[model samples]
Target: MQIPEFSKEQSALLARFLAEQKDALSLAQTHGYLFAVICAPEPLDVHQWLEQVVPGCDGQMDEQVLFAFMALYQQISEHVFETGYSLPVSLQFNSAQQPYLDMQECQHWSQGFMLGAQGYIAKLLAAPQLASELKEALETAQQSLCFFILDSADIASIANQHGLTEGLLCQQQYEVMNEFAAGFAELIEAVAVNSQLYNDEGWG
Candidate 1:
């Protein structure tokens, strides 16, 4: 299906709406979180997940705005399922923003993803064979969130300790985050397949 591209204007609008709802996650984070949830082994109900992330979404958002968000969700889910990759281009920090703000937003996106994944961690953990890989990916993503918590002094100190420029450190973190996303996508596919096999065997 040809899903409409999630445009900047829509992003801004959603951000504003989320802000009005006193949501902790920005539009970017929310999108990232939802994308992760959609890629889960046994995905959450789309409408239920939407309501959780976007409070009052069904009642408050106009038809057009609601449709746009749903379309974006569907598109991301389909992309991940068909391609075995998350929509990194769409999920990444917006470069047009100031560097500091971009970094902060990236942290928020990671936090949101972690929060989303926590809901399914129990199920994933129950499968001991997959637990270690999923846990490692989650830990790497969690580490990425630490960058936003450091003061300038702390950041500089850490950079110096690593014998790397601050810019290089940030770039390294970005690469790690990308790897985390890819790892997560693989986990999701594995879980989905396992669930299918279990069902096929009438193991329910």
Candidate 2:
């Protein structure tokens, strides 16, 4: 059997993506847990630092959007695992989302993680000024989102332990993330317009 070979660029990007995702997951799961406790506002600081290291981060992506997505994703994750809400939309997939998919426990954590991944991929492929910036953004955003996940999981653990209710926290996060995803949404739209124009000599 042969392992498929990717272009050097693809391999590099994938390697970075995997490494970043690993860091993100670890941070998310353990950051705020009671037994395996995790803490810090450093996660947010880390995001700010990522913006400095990665130029065009704000232009290409929105921090608020990322926050919302993570929040929603974390909620979806808890609900799904605890039999809260199970919609196909909650379990949907795209090429950019696969890396964050976690089945051992919380699926929404993975989903939330991939939400950013999808946006990162779109930016990397489309924005020359932002290529390197995105690399760092992915790394930083992964950390912050993980921390966000950790916090949510901590709350859920308590809720589960004490028999409490989970509310619209995740829905709010999803709305925010969707707003952020709109950045990639626009990028995708631009790519489509450009491709169409080039194909038929209709540049506008």
lDDT of 1 by residue, 1-204 (tens): 466777777766777767877554667677677766875655677676777777556546676667677776766776666755442433244567534225666656666676677655555546555546555654555466335445667777889999988766766766666665656666655553553432433323
Work out the TM-score per prediction: 0.70, 0.23
Error of 2 at 28 (Å): 20
Q: What is the clash count of model 2?
A: 3
Candidate 2 is scored at a TM of 0.23
Candidate 2 structure quality by residue, lDDT tens digits, 79-114: 433533322223335586532322322434434345
Model 2 spans > 4 angstroms off:
1-128, 131-151, 154-166, 188-204
RMSD of 2: 17.5
lDDT score, candidate 2: 0.35
Each candidate's number of clashing pairs is 0, 3
Residue pairs in collision within model 1 = none
